[model samples]
Target: MAMKHFTIQDAATMYGVKEWGYGFFGINSKGHLEVYPTRDENLSCDIHEVVTHLHKKGIRTPVTLRFPQILATRVTELNEAFHKAMKEYDYEGDYQGVFPVKTNQIKEVVDHIVKAGYKYRYGLEAGSKAELMIALSMNLHAEALVTCNGYKDESFIRIALLALKAGRNVLITVEKMTELPLILKVAKELKVEPLLGLRMKLNAMGSGKWESSAGDHAKFGLNTQEILDTVDTLERRGLLDSVQELHYHIGSQITDIRKIKAAIKEATRVYAKLVKRGVPLKYLNVGGGLGVDYDGSRTTFHSSMNYTMEEYAADVVYTTKDICTQEQVPVPNLLSESGRAIVAYHQVLVVDVIGLIDTTHTKYRVELSGQEPQILKELAYTRDNISVKNFAEMYHDAITQKDELITLFNLGYLGLDDRAKGEILFWEVCRKLSRILSYKSLKYIPEEFQDLNKSLADKLIANFSLFQSMPDHWAIDQLFPVMPIHRLKEKPTLSATLCDITCDSDGKVEKFIDLKDVRDEIPLHEPKSGEPYYLAFFLVGAYQDTLAMRHNLFGSVNEAHVIVNEDEDFRIQQIVPAQTTDDVLKSVHYDPDELVEGPTRRRKISANSDANEALKTALTEQRKLHTYLEMN
Candidate 1:
């Protein structure tokens, strides 16, 4: 037998980097994961170096690494794809995109998007009052559109009206007919003609998890009759001229391009009908459904998209052009709130493997003094006779004998020693079955042993909390690509499942993304004691940060903003430290001052000896420390 050696290319293929990374991520010859900011550049930045630098600077494990260069690149790729599509189709109107702030409301994330997307005049889309305030604070380009979406109140409408009066291209989309009067009233009070848009509830729906964002029974948007009634009300008031944009969102993370094309055709027809009624709609806002291929399978799965950005843009442009030309209406300006597509690749959640738990650590062989139970002897025989050729039959026999051994022990016929031997023998059989299943030449694993890998996988306890980092995986079963950041040049011989540091039983990631299907476990190398092994969850920039919860009082992890230099080296622009114990207490309406003062007073009253004083000092230091576990 010969030991097979694996290369960096094998790591790339195993992790689906070429498909999901979109050329920004790869492994270098040094076995470190590298970030290539630009496709034309030959230079690369090692992600391991970034982590090492952060560690040197006192930033611990479970730090999020933000690559602003990737954000800029994605924004450029999205806009350029549309621009190329418009040119090829000879489309009359231009393409405009606004990032929905709800996808990631972090100030740094929004700032990076605004900075990177300036060339494309990319703007912000606010779905709430708080989000609108953030959007209004940004100094967007003069031509950039500020889209005000979601359910609005009087204050929301007033703010939108003020933004419009301030010469911003603000579009207040009416989700329901009830919102139209609020816009009109706010506009009349401010004596400013507001830019109004209607979000139509299209009959055509999108595909994937969020397809409910549109369709007849959607949560937002006005029905056909409600839209007509609103239009008539505006027309009677001579305010139909204010209706300058038509908006419709099929869903978020739409995986199928055909669904996008169908939605575009339907929305364009709605735009043409509105124009025929003398509404003079100039903007057709195709609300965001642009998806990222998280699994990199290129299939129409919930986790991955079937089409490319260029294909999406081409279909959007050509469909709108064809529909408008048939209806003899002008090609309206195209606007998309593609938040997920723009930000999904901009951040990676890095966590270190603190330790591994091996389930098959116990030796199975037992010393029998010729007085062992018949059932225990049979289980031992099955374990000894287990081989690849007869693993299935031997496993079944072991299971039956183990069950009989447990029954005999409960009936007082077998002693604890015999029962222990039986259990060990069963686990040894499982271990041998898993080893046989791992043969490289094996094509298909039997259904009975399909879960053998999961059973034998090493449970890697990670330092990060799943609730605070990847909420989608916990809440919606979303798959994020997780891979080792280093040791790519070596072969990963162990299958592992990641268990977070949280106390909740649900705080573990067992499902992983694969090229052809979902993987039950991730391939990982055997951890060397006293050495740090790091893994990263990729394409988590969208909806993760904002959606993270404070489960078990675990707050936000430390964040490192990495900027790529001209020489392709990296620099940490900023580091946001994780929340302290006081921060978590304050969030839950606890007074930190009162807590500290009470603890101090109690310590003083109870401190009569040197040991008590030392305990008080230790308690004070513990109170100031962060909530997460500190790795030794």
Candidate 2:
């Protein structure tokens, strides 16, 4: 039989992977995010080398690279997809999307989004007064919409009205019934009537962690009674004409397609009712629930969505068109605040794999002398005699002996050497027992021993921090697609958990994406000699970068923007260095000037004793390095 040779594309194109490559993302020929590369020639740029270069330049541990080209491609694809759907459905409505600033508020990211979307007039969504200011300041085209959401006070409403006063197309969405009165009061006091939108509390609920964010009893939005009161108040004040848009967010990462149809129908009815009451509504704001398949599963999992982008667009347009036409209402513009879907695929967080623990090291192996200890003999027996039929009984006996050995060693009944031998033998036995049990019965395997798969498991030390860079994963158990940047040709031999360098115990990912369950880590191939190993976390552009916090004073990671130029060459632009120790201290109101003194202040005039001589030499060295003790 002849051997078949396959390139990275060919392997990635196999079976279902090819569809993900097209619909989701792939490295383009210019080393950018695209459907696939232009050709094999485009694979010349090494993502791993980028990490190594950054690490060598003192940008150690974790670093996030923002690819502006990918952001451009994402904005383009989203617009094109919805536009194509409109054409296919014979829809009369125009499609517009806004990048919710809450998803990611990084300056470079927002700048790149605006630049890429200048032709399409893609706008920004704001959930706060500050975010509205940012959106108002950045949106270049007057045709784009500046959407204001979230809880609002007088100042927040006042600023949004001011944005409208400045000729910006601002839509202030009333989240609560109370906000409506405040919004009306602010607009009347300021004498600026801005376009108004209402986020309705629909009866339909989405499925995800944020499912509770909507529905009839949602935290935000107006109920049926509240909606009627709002309409009455508007009619009385002659401001009903300002109610131009109806918005509803079932949830973020809505996995169920049926929920989409239901929510749109519910929201569409609300729009129709408002229209029936003489409130002219011209827009349907389907607030940001278009989910991404984070787990690559076409299932209704919280981390994954069941429907495709085309299906999602079709549902939104078809449902709205049907409801509006049936009610004899004009077709409204379709607006989506799909922050996650828009920005998720636009960025990849590439972090290097520092090192791994070799579980098979000889130092961890057991070598028993004559008259072996009871725990060692039991371990040997467990390793040699434990089978699927007797695994449970042997495991119990081994555990008992293990506890006894540890207790004896702590109480000085056993020697240090014996304790070491006992632990090694017990671990060897546990590994073998786990292997035997996994085949016939894995249910009995303890959670602590679940890492003992037959395949060699390597602990991967990632450069990124869970608390600092990927807080959502640490906080909400959100799973992102992670894979090696290179070495696609090699089969991975090890599966291990990723441990971040944070002092918090919750800073590790124990669950990773697997066939049956979300796992803590994926299998990784061993590194070739002198070659740096790296893995990239995909679909992290939204919310992860800006929402990251500095835990344990670890500081933030360095960031760089990667752009694919018109010549199809990749270039690094706008490198913002990470904060230094002094800089971070200054941020927290620490005055470095007050705590510092010159080296001459610490010098002793009489240095005859040995201690004085040593102190004088230490002071000289510290002065050379520009370091000083705070005590001075």
Candidate 3:
């Protein structure tokens, strides 16, 4: 049979790159995975070449690359989407997109977002005190908005009122009834009439793991009756006009558009009713749930979304206009806190495979002596006679004889040598069975028999900390796109899964993204000896950065930022090195000086020059170098 022909398109299709890349990425003629970050075809470079550039600077694999161009493009796309929607529908309400910094708290990310969004009066939404400080510090131009959310103490409320006093376009969203009295007192003390947003708990719950946190009983928002009571309280306090926005959050990463439409309809109706009652609301803040298609299924899958950005914008704008037109109230300005969708695509984590664990590499002939037990003889017979025609019965018999071998060993009927020989023969037989069952003539494959591929898939040991780099995968089983960064024109002859260089058994990735469902293994090319096999984990800019933990003391990885320029030119603008051993120790409150001295004093080495020089060199390198495994 002729070898199956493979092309770059074939590799792209196998990895579903086009399905989820959305024009920011593609395959080049040289079989390299190139990134066209600004959607400009001419301004592109393969990721492998970028990594090679870094490699020349002594930066090893397991690095992160941030494309500011992609980030800017996404912001522009979002703002333009809303603009087109408003123009097409002739909607009266204005649009301003507020990026919730809780999605990604990196300073460079937020700063680039501000610069990119300056045209649209784009703003930042803060969910904590520190994030609020970042929002205020980053967007002090007064045209950019600063939304203060989450539960507030006196200090939090006081800070928001102070921003209002500073002539900032800041809105302090009231999440609970108790927050109203607190906000009023803070405003009274500061003598500043605060711009407020009332967060209403709507009846529309989305479909996902976050469904439990949405709807009327959500942890953050107020009920309908409570909203009315708060409105009445504001009326009594002679501050009804202070309520400038009505906010509602369905959930984060909502998969279904029907739920979004329902939530928008409910939120618009609430805004309309409040407007009729003379609340003077100017902004209807429909909170974030815009999802990224991590799996590219584009269905109601929890990891994917069923709507496009334009569709989401149109639904929000038109639905609000339709509701308010019927209620005879003026349309309010729309603000969406779609943080996940905005920041999820700009960062890519690239890790190099350090080693491969092939189970069949140790395969050999296991000769059986005549004095061996019947179970061992049966296992040897199964191994030498296995084929596709009778693999099922042969596999079954091998399993049976293996179980009996274990029983014989436990019962002292088999010696150590006999048990070892039986174990080796059983695995050899199973390997042959797996190899033959994948033939072209095999029509029907049993489920258990098919699972042999997963069991036998090569293990690619990667050189990055899973807990530190991609925490969402470990915490909630979120799937990111994983594929080889180069060699796309060649066929992937190996089925493999990833294993991070952590001691914990859970530090591995066995499930991969698939069109129909989850896959157990990923197709990958065989790693060449003495060559770095690089793989990238894409779409990880959202919550993974801040949510990462210091599992096994792997603090952070090296990061480089790329800025694409006109005429197909790009430059590495900035590089942030990984944390050093001294830095990691200091972060955990361990003094590096004390640690070094303690080990040296405990060792009590001779006062010789050679011994002292060796210890000093080792200690100096340990304190200065990074925590990851050194390649040089």
Candidate 4:
């Protein structure tokens, strides 16, 4: 028998992949992701080997693999697309993009963005003072614009002023009327004039799950009245020329292109008005709201978008230029804060399947003891007689028998021996019945067993911490593409929901992305004999790494950076190992030093011991040494 082979193309199709720009994952002649699992004539790296390598290195259970080249490619593509749009549209404006630090604050991720984006002079957008500090520290390009947003206090304004003093061109966006006064006071105290901007609350609403992020009643930004008031305040302070930018944002993951055009028109009109009122603004900061095609539908749905990156840039530039040109205002430098589009496709999370529980792989067998309970016999009969057509009926009958058996045992009507038989019999029947109803060919599943479907959903024990790898799934119900990375030649036989190694019940990803509701189970292939199976989670690069919390005491996953050079040999740049038991304990304020020393003392005192005691002491010392080595 030949072993079944699966390729990356198989996984891409299962993900409903559509070419948004370039291929993130595609099938090669040998299968698996384009870079990993390269083609070999007879023997090649399979998903099993890829997973086993990491597991052998002590990077098991959960890991996030980040490809720096993919991130660089995504950033390059976005910048090039917008520039191409500018040329195609013949718009007089230029593209100046900034990565929002709030999206993903991982040091390595931010460091790479700053380094790789040097040619494009890609800037950073900060939403808070702490984020502002990071942006200022990382932004080596003096020409790159560091735009500061969010509600500001004296300290926030002071930091922005300090950034300007350091010779970095920092734009401070006033979200409220009072922030203008704070900025004025801080700038004067610091003896440095700050470049100012205002976030306008546009009347045009955006489309998507976060539509309220930019409209009239949005959480942040200034209303029409406040916008006018800020202009007067700046003029009164003799800093009108310092107010060089106007900004607005509808929301993130904005699906509708029309809303973008409307937002541009509205913000442009405000920009023109600011110029007419003697406010010398020279830039327009269209805040972050760029959408990502999470579902790959590409139909203007909330989780998806119809417009391409080029189309988006052309729309913004032309709309702003057309309106400003008509109003006789010069086209300001075009700026956009698009964090999702720049970083979403750069990271992938790889997890391994440890085992699965299946009770229906065997034929019906009856085990009858002299003291066996009567209900156990009935359950055995239910399992033996069940058929696809009568599966539901048989399941109900078995449930009734199971209840009677439980009651009989409680009342001492049955013995322990009978109770054990009844328990096993009932579970086997339930499992088998569930298998029947959940068969793919079953035209319709009865409504009464909907909850039962979830209860009996195939339990695939994957080596991962869902909360640590994909926090958005647990925090905001954000869904990403998930599928097996191999075994295309063989068809899937199990409908499985993945469960992580975490002890918390909520650590499972039972609900997945679907058109109707969160999915119950995804199709999974059976592992070939003496072979292992693994799966990969895609599109996890944006905020997952930085935002992941230490839920259930699980630390960050082991991360590797793969760089594809000219020869196509992926050079593994850096491999940051995951936290050890001691590391996790220290993060929670526990002094692992004391806990670590406990073992050494215990080992020295085998002052009196049998072989078993000596063996236990040696094991304790080995465990402590392992923990120390991993942490270091």
Candidate 5:
């Protein structure tokens, strides 16, 4: 309400688009957000066009748009960053990267990453038997490597060995000492020597929420003594040549460069010592911790990364080379599992804001009659008298009088008409106080007044289940960039928090990404009636897809794979429809036909033939529809 001159530059800055876009997301001259797949403004596609195209094909909002070009570009950037770093550092070993399939096991996403990086000899990392199947099926280059991580059962080990015998470079990293004996036995039984690895528990700790992924008490990996004992056992068995990779993962979404440098140095020291001991280690697998700055603050915050891909690659290459040089050992071929950085920018979830819940009571006036209750009159006065000078005191007075009005109503002393008026007056007081303080504080608004914004702002009811789309936000408070995908040229005069269409109260997002701090409400344009106002949630490709829940029985959203053509135009490559209600019910072990049996029996017995026919059609359609709130 205070600022009249808002430019596209202001919108970009407000949303941190340029900071976190990584040259892939930006606003175009037409006031719509565009995807610059090639990092050139001339070669971009309007995201709104992608959504409209999908709409024309019978798909509605609450669809996940996948930019395969973005995924491909990220793969190239990561490998090229490491290559450039290795070149500058004069490192002897080659750089080969693997995308851990656990981040996003979607077929299209994985296929694109592999195809994009096939030239650079990129491969997939599997942590379980199912993912191992994905890796073996990948048309990976003959020289590309597939590294097996996580705890391995006999079945998991057998598949790795079979692949190795079939001429695929598969490295099985032993997380526990017991897994080593199984690997040795399985190799002996199959008569095919297994290329092995050791998941070392690093002495150094990474930074951010998952820092414990590498330290002494890490969930997996071998400790120092265990590593030595495994090496000794391999040496005694004459299998030293089979040990090919020494892998270590600090964590996922590492935020600090110092932690990465320290961890790499430690990992290389161990690799060099093993090489000196005649273990023939050739690959130093640095596990996936490359972070994507979802918030674009470039700080050490959990949601942000202080370092760039260039800096991360440089630190990794230089640190490894430096440590190897100190120990007089040749540098090992490098491999990284940076899954988050590779896939986070490749997907955007667009949900429609179907309705608005505004409680500001803009039409309410304090024209109370003389017969009104004393407390109601007091709240009306507070609403009328709030100002920049006396707003703080009037805010406190409004709170007191509003509470008394509620008490009077509960005690049967106040009528419904007067009670409703008092409720209107309380929210009006909040709105007036907020406007008065908006221009005064500039920076240091009191906490109470800052929270007043949420109380006065509208609650936009979006048509997607937060629990089904983004579980991390609810489970870990992770922030994803959320804003209107179109209408950037128009100044947003309304502010609101987003709520999904779930019955649970936790299925809402009040905290939003900001440059300076976490924002309580997002600046939004007023929604036009009968039109779907869409908001795109950015950087949700990593871990959100698989971690989503079926809370309230809401199924997955439709997925759109968007690829740019030769002239940098738009085209929908493929569409994956969401699970139908019947499908979801079957997943939960519910038989649709059985559930409809009683209704069908009742219809058959009834005399209203037309109504029964309508009921049958409705049941058929309802069973086939998606579980999300269908918007018109």
Candidate 6:
């Protein structure tokens, strides 16, 4: 039989590359995955070349590739989209975006965003004191605004006041009524007029997994009475001008466009009311909820958004404009803290497959002697009689016979050898049934055999730690696009689940994104004995890096930053190597130097030269080795 052919298009479609890739990632004619820094340019850089380059430089698998060009492009795209919308709608308000530092917080990622967004006068949003410190240290442009959010102590308030005094555009958003008094006291002590904003708890809830971030029962934000009291208190204290911004966060990863429209309309109404009350609300901060289509379904699914960036900008601008016009209030400056949408596409995690555990290796017939157990003979008979027409019935019979054999063995009526033979026969029957089911149409397959493929699929053991790299997948069931980096031109004949190197059983990625639903297995090529196969997880730049944990003492992996030059040639801008064993030990409060010294001291005290030499060699090896598996 002729080998089935698979093209790059097939790989792209199977992995939803066109839907989620945003034209930055695709398969090239060389049968290797490529990254396009600019979609309009004809130049492209092969990812395999980047991996090979890193390997030659002593970096191995389980590495993350960071493309700063993609981050810059996304920032430009977002600013341009809003600018175009404002122009088309003829809105007078200016659009300013703040990168939420909590999304990544990595020094390199934050530095790149600051550099990329300089042209747009982009700002930063800090949720905690540490984040605020990072934001304050950044060399943001003069016109950029730095918004301080989340719960704050006196120190946090003092820091914001200090930043305001430093000639920075700093806004402190009050989450509760009590926070206003603290901010006022801090402002008086510092002798600086603090810029204050209010986070209103809107009744319009968001959509998708993070819907709890908004609505009436949200964890943060004030109610209607609280808002009125806040304004009243500010007026009484004669600090009403301090309240310059009104902010509301519907949620994160909001999938429905209608929910956004509703939230914007309601927030606009509140803004109009405040404007009528003689409050100088100059900034309308629409907190981040912009969604990324991780699965590329383009529906109201949790992993996707139904609206485009253009539509989102238009809706937000037009809704605010229409409401402000009706209320006869000046349109406020627009601010969005969209961190996920800007950073999700810039990083890709690549892992290497170590080996595979095939479960369908018992397809051959199980030899039986005439003196075997009656139940074993019955199972063999069912396995032999399984045809395309009677595969389902034979499968049922085999299962029944196997169960009986197990019960007999437990009751001391069947030998261990007989039970083993019966188990083999039962699996052979399932293998034949799976083949027959594959020949039948999807709809015609029996419900009993629907999960046969998943049960029989191979388990591909990969050389990465799921808890250390992609924790959201295990914690919140977040789906990421996964696909093989090479071998796109060859058809994948094996259905497998990716199992990470972590010892915990929860380290396996079994649920994969599909067009209509989640799939149980990912299609992959059969593993070769002496070759390496790599797979990449896409859209992981947003939260994975910061959210990774040290479970099983598996520290962060190696990272490579790639810069695409004007001529489309890729350069290794930076290579952050993975954590060594000694590094991880130090993190957990283990003194590596003391550990080596104590053992060596004891060996020397005993006057054992061989023991001392062995300890020295062991210590040297431990300090140089990484925590992850070093594949041969």
- List per-prediction Cα lDDT, in the order shown: 0.87, 0.72, 0.88, 0.74, 0.88, 0.89
lDDT of 2 by residue, 1-632 (tens): 97565445643532123333334445433323332222223433445555555666655435677666667777887888889888988998898888899988988888888888888888899998889889988956779889998998999888889879978999999888878878888888889886988878888999989988776678888888877888888888888889888888888889999999998887888788778878888889988888887777678888888898789988889999899889888778999988887677766676666667665432477656658767677777776787777777887777888898999888888898888777777767767675686685355665655555522355666666777677889889898767776666654556566766667778776766543466645666675656667777777877887777767655566776655444334557767776554555566686544334333345554445666556556644433231111110
Evaluate model 4: give its lDDT. Answer: 0.74
TM-score of each: 0.96, 0.86, 0.96, 0.84, 0.97, 0.95
Error of 1 at 68 (Å): 0.7
Q: Which is the winner by lDDT between candidate 1 and candidate 5?
A: 5
Q: lDDT score of model 6?
A: 0.89
> Per-residue CA lDDT of candidate 4, range 1-632, in tens?
98656545554555454343135655434444443221122222233334455667665535566666666766777788778877876777677788999998888888888887878888999989889989988955768889998887888888888979978889898888778777888888899988988888898988977887766678888898888877777778787788888888888888989989988998899889888888887789888888877766676766578887778887887788789889997788888899988778777787767767563333344577645555777888887788898887888898899889989988988988677677677767777777787679988877887777566557787777888888888887777877766664455777778888788888777765554445677777765555557677877877887787787777777777655544334445777877766677778897765654555454665546565456555554643331221220
Clashing pairs in model 4, backbone N/Cα/C closer than 3 A: 6-487, 6-488, 8-32, 61-463
Q: Candidates ranked by lDDT, best first?
A: 6, 5, 3, 1, 4, 2
In model 5, the runs with Cα more than 4 Å from the true position are 1-3, 441-444, 566-568, 602-609
When summed lDDT is taken over every stretch of 10 residues in candidate 3, the lowest stretch is: 357-366
Name the runs in model 1 displaced over 4 angstroms. Answer: 41-43, 362-371, 411-417, 438-445, 566-568, 593-608
Residues 1-632, model 5: lDDT tens digits: 67567778888988889988878898877788888886767778888888988898899879999989888889989999999998998998999998899999999889998999999999999999999999999989888889999988999999999999989999898999999889989999999998988889998998998987678789999998998999999889888888889999889889999989989988888899888888898899988899989888999999999999999999999999889889999999998999999999989999998888866776566678878988888988888888877877888898888889999999999999989889998988888777777785655666777677877778889999999899999999999999888889988878889999989999999999987788889999989988778899999999999999999899999989888765547888999999888988998999888766657674446677687668777877889888887778
Which residue pairs come into collision in candidate 2? 510-520, 511-519, 511-520, 512-519, 512-520
User: Which model scores highest in TM-score?
Assistant: 5
Selected candidate, larger lDDT, 2 vs 3 = 3
- Write model 3 residue lDDT over 341-429, tens digit each, in one string: 88888999999888888665444568876778888788988999988788888899988898999998999988998888888888788
TM-score of 6: 0.95
Q: What is the lDDT of residue 584 in candidate 4?
A: 74
User: In model 4, which range of ten residues has the least summed lDDT?
Assistant: 36-45
TM-score, cand. 1 vs. native:
0.96
What's the CA error at residue 42 for candidate 5, in Å?
A: 2.3
